[model samples]
Target: MVLAMRHGAHLIWVGLLLCCMVDMGATMEFTGAEGQWARFPMWNACCESEMSFNMKTKSSHGLLVYFDDEGFCDFLELLIHNGKLSLRFSIFCAEPATVLTNTAVNDSQWHAVTIWRNFKNTTLMVDNEVKWVEVKSKRRDMTVFSHLFLGGIPPELRSVALRLTSAVVKDHVPFTGWITDIKVNNTESALLNSAGVINDLCGAAANMCLNGGVCNVINDEPTCDCSQTDYQGKDCSEGKISGFSFGPLSVLLTISNSSPLTKQQHDMIIYRFPSFQAVLVVQQFTENADILFL
Candidate 1:
């Protein structure tokens, strides 16, 4: 009995190992090389079902995209639609039309795109920033897709079984970069898996720096060196904040006789900065307010 139990336990261990191997082998990568793409065909019964999806894309340039097919509703494409470098949700022939955000996305870095929809409402987020939102009282038609195409396809080719490509085109540009960490409906997809993969490509790439900042890696950590300039922060994102005297400038606030606030009356003071300089709003709340500037 003891020997039989031990044999069964060993079989279970072997099964677990095989599962791990399958998971680790699921991450697929494609270079932005010409004419390359990836497709995953799935057997989804109710393919038109609404889904909540989270996908991450790490690209240095160009647009990232994906396409899905839903039989009756036909097709849906998530891309930088209408030739703009912004995120768009396009459902072919849908009544409400395609939705898009004004935020430019060709920044050549890692960006996380999240889409959530329950037929009535749809929300999209990019790089932890909510890009677009729509709420409707009536439910919308969704795609009943059996396959997903990652990059390369004409928007009109819904029923066609065309292979994925890396070729560039007018309507849709093939994604030429790395994509990972994708989850649908809180469940990880086998085709979009990134288990046990060391994603050091960000560090390996030559021009990871932006805005002329120097890129360097120290002890496995990547850092951008930006020094002695008005542009502050690690990525040199902050604009120039100079031209003012260095030391701490003191100011005295005196209530204006023209617009004086009565006792026990609260006043709100708001300062709007000029357009040429940085946009800063200084608001003050007081029983008696005073405006002071040097």
Candidate 2:
């Protein structure tokens, strides 16, 4: 049939190029001198598989968001405003999340940022597609984790790295980004990998989420009175893990020799073998005897 319809259209174009080669894995790596800058805290983070950055702002340029008392902070900002590429994705620790963009941000080269999740929703990818998402209701503790911090912000005294070639001007390597293949796709639902994480505060490490109630320290960034349901934010670190229910013969076997028979000698061995005794009596005496030799 015409060579089987050209080999079934070349096997459906090689199965759509292997479903666009799904690869979301990068475990963090950065190299910045002349004023060093590197910060990543999305709880258990190990992202950075691709990176790129270069700045020459004539104006508008600030990403020092610190909400020690407002909301759980989702105030995304990536500007170049008026000229374009002015993005915004805020939540005020409220409903349905927000996102405002100015578009066109390919500047000089390499650009990829992906923070996908499951168990519900939580997406933010620029290159692999999706650029905004956060539809949470009663789930924020499934814990795949998300509390990323890079090249600045969330720093009280220092750390979060960022000195930037002391304002580079040589051949211009400025912020030559490199953050590769970071992945977190909860198969499509694990509450979208629960956006969460929390690290030693009071001592100060910051980065905890949960907007609705409790988790307050209002003035130093930790304000989340989101109305509680038993989950605030930043502490879903892989969700502490929990799951179990097995029985197909649930074996633990190991009581080979036990003795303690009194009370009329255990009712004369259960009335002298009452058809292989199965008289259940737990607590108040605790006794179980099984002896079969047919």
Candidate 3:
């Protein structure tokens, strides 16, 4: 009985170590440099399909993911444009459908991104905020002949007229950030087929965060928390803003005072800012009633 108990405890320890290893190996950081990319097997987004991933970045513009039929028939692209996540896709050579999120994800924080497609309808979710659009194309299925490209595309496929069908896809900058646990159809995991991609944001010898910023290992990647630091930005190297940090309260007040929010708009903001933990007491005086935040 004693021997059996000891063996059981040993097995549990081994299982825990394996789980940690799997977690550490899951994240991949993109350098955002030219010719830096990862290629995964093509995602069959024809008809009903889904793709989801976690991403962290500070770049305002970069191509997060792209796949299509050698740029000929149909294509889909997820990118960061103007600090917001944008999803663009086309079916049967029709005008592409674009769904862009209002909440920005380029704040160097881990954000869950999901894309769901059903026939012509496509939905994009960033954290709890959601936006969707329907394609006007007559065809329902999207044909993709190329492998799914993440971070960027191969330099050889850069030509717009000859190679890629979508001209706009080539113009977006390459992604420079960390992406992990990419799932297609909610089952298949995307594995990187490229070299030079770092497994962790901060490797053994170097710390990416600067200016006394706290470096935390989240999802096996080094993340800089600039909240308590004098400096801000992705690596905590940027100059600090000259004001009190009121957290989400200040943002809510600014938006409430700027214009009247529709129910849909108010709901979206509420999803993004679910709590006002920083402020002691907060009130919003609108035409209808006063909403308190605490």
Candidate 4:
């Protein structure tokens, strides 16, 4: 029995150590120079492909591309067009539906961009900001498509690429920056397995939680649950309302006048219905008074 217990404890310790290692090594570094791009196979991006990536650009005016497939100029792709972050969806050479941010993204800073589709609506997120828009056009079958190029478009002829003859090539410009933390359909992609690349974001390692709250990753998004009952906010950064206390059948309230010379009138009216067993309370207080209800 002793040996068995020791072995089980050892296994648990090893598992925890492995989990810590994975959490620590969760981000990936992308060198967007020298025509370097990540390639995800066709099977990985078939159908409605949702993508989320964090990037820091070395230069401002370059492209931040997500997908580059032939035959359609837009059809299920995300890119930075004319400095605006744009998400485009096109079908069978039809008029492409696009969602663009009002502000420009060529700020030479780290930004998180997420693009996903829900029925006809395309959702885009830049850090904490989000924009959701429905596409007027009908959805088409994209399962037949094969392969997707990330960060950079595929070069023509594979060697000694010709000058800009096709307009498509010119538009499919490569991103020049550092890209990390990429997810597709809420799942981490295998293409981010480059050297010195971490799997998760920086928050996964430390300080994601605040005020003793627990930090959790939901759908690749970091969220915090405030530990104290009187604390609230995204990272438990704000204080919660702790003014009122109510019993099963009673409520307590206290009010104080702000100034000695000022006359403050406060009224709390309650209406009770004996037939319905319902009660409603209306409170009117002056600005000079501080009221606390428990």
Candidate 5:
């Protein structure tokens, strides 16, 4: 009886791993934007500083995630339509998308804002809660890697595009010690079975445009800013092979929240598309590849 139970445990673990496998993500990974943002508020102690979201292109797309002493999220819009971020998994957050005032953690301690994505939803987990439920969302689309905004928007949206600079010191407030860490992960996934896996990916890859162009990501072989209209879409993988590369074939793209692939991500990509031609395209990329890939 003991041996049978142990075997069963192993299968369950394997099953969990399998669910993550179906979530092979196509992302532009970035890292070490981790750690602390320098204690400089934008401009002055109390000023509306512009922190531009250097997107897939130089032009603005829309707002996604914002951090610093004050925080706001433009990505939580999906819950209205999808019902939940995921039916297979649950996430928790102490100081979540409540407000930029940093009350989500409740203890005033260091907290993490985990934005989780699955076939059905975009769940924000503060720390880790077991009984977590869906929260109101504003994200229009969900992708493997998304464009994020820090600081605040420039007056470009207004007339003060120049004032939308990064956080700087102001009055007596100093904008100091406002510890904030913003990171995203594909993290966990839920697969009902093989059939559900495929169904999920199609829906997962199936464009929400939920938050509108306000928030978007790099999945489905996405691409942006095509010259002369040769290519377009989230991953640049959508165009015809007609213009299939006789040129220099060099493109410079940025990847954010990146890391070495777990065995699962690697294998899933291969299983899904044998023609991936995987290579080490600079393991530590430093750009947000998903904002609005139109």
Candidate 6:
């Protein structure tokens, strides 16, 4: 009877682990690479609609969202420029209206972005800050025939002028960051097709950085800097190290582990320990792991 109860408990633990892993796959990571993009079903913002999403990045410039009518009539674009959010849209091809936010969102922190459109009047809100803009064109409604594009536009449509009504968007940099919890008109679920985007967690949440370590985005990748903390590792969850001495020659420290170090982590270690020729550390959880120093 005791053995059967233990087996049942183990099965329950495994089931919970699998559930947690699936939940972590909701967030999407945009590589910011050229032509990297995600497409969603056409957004019906003709007269009145609302769109909201959570985003985090360290890029000063990148196209966050774009949609249009194949270069014929109307379009809308939300982009990050100079660490600020800018919204531009056109109706009936008249002079495009622009609404720029004073709040900077390129600080590598998660921000809630909301866009509310009611005919000619539009409201853009980032967290608590809000801005408004109104179109001057006679037509109040926006015509968007193309599928909504996030992160960037399709590579094939770059050269096609007619396909992309907004010429400036074609030249805009692609977004490299994390976007999740996207909703249209308060609806949370939507069919999303993506390219060059990872549908997994990459330090998207503040909790990803353990031991009070701060998370920063560099080159579109999330990295944890453990300089201030005693722990030294990618997420700052490893055992603490005390002291180090610089010898006449370089030193190599290797630990047998599981996961390999990321490029950013590797560079960080090199910069922190310049005297050491190289540090090869394999990250894993083992009681009898071997550490070699040469």
lDDT of 4 by residue, 1-294 (tens): 999999999999999997774454244444444444445544333345577777765444444544434444334656676766777665444465778786566677768888765545668888777887665655543322434456654444134333222234345556666665556776765552121122254246458556666543444455665644446777665554445567876565543222233337334434344545656454445655444332
For all the candidates, what are their Cα RMSDs to the real structure? Answer: 20.2, 22.4, 20.3, 21.9, 21.6, 16.3
Positional deviation of residue 150's Cα in model 1 after best superposition, in angstroms: 1.3
Q: How far in Å is the alpha carbon of 257 misplaced in model 6?
A: 30
Give one digit per residue, the lDDT tens place, for model 1 in 1-294.
Answer: 999999999999999997774454223344444444444444231322322332334443434545445333333446655432343333333443345665545554545566655453456666556644333323354454545555543334433334222122334545654565545654554442111122343336446555555443333355665554345566655443323433344333443322344677654544454455443334455665443443
Question: How large an RMSD does model 4 have?
Answer: 21.9
Task: Compare candidates 1 and 4 on TM-score and give the better one.
Answer: 4
**TM-score for each of the candidates:** 0.41, 0.19, 0.60, 0.47, 0.22, 0.60
Task: State the TM-score for model 6.
Answer: 0.60
**By TM-score, who's the top model here?**
6
lDDT of 3: 0.74
lDDT of each residue in 214-278, candidate 2, tens digit only = 33333334444333333323442211112234455331222222234556653222223344544
Better of 4 and 6 by lDDT: 6
Global local distance difference test of model 4: 0.54
Best by lDDT: 6
* Cα error of candidate 4 at position 226, Å: 54
Candidate 6 minimal-lDDT segment of 10 residues: 266-275
Q: lDDT for each of the candidates? A: 0.45, 0.32, 0.74, 0.54, 0.27, 0.78
lDDT (tens digit, per residue) of candidate 6 on 1-294: 999999999999999997774354357788887667877778888888999888999999999999999979798999999999999998998888999999999999989999898998889999999999998989878888898888999878897887888987988989989988788887763535555566543445557667756554444455675666666688887755444555665343443223445546431233344543566655443445434343
Candidate 3 residue-wise lDDT, 147-213, digit = tens? 8888888767885456786777777778988988788987746454543355544455256777666
Q: What value of lDDT does candidate 6 attain over all alpha carbons?
A: 0.78
Write the residue-wise lDDT of candidate 5 on 197-264 in tens digits.
11223345544322111112223222232333333444343332223223243334322222344437
Q: Where does the lowest 10-residue lDDT sum fall in candidate 3?
A: 250-259
What ranking emerges by lDDT with the best candidate at the front? 6, 3, 4, 1, 2, 5
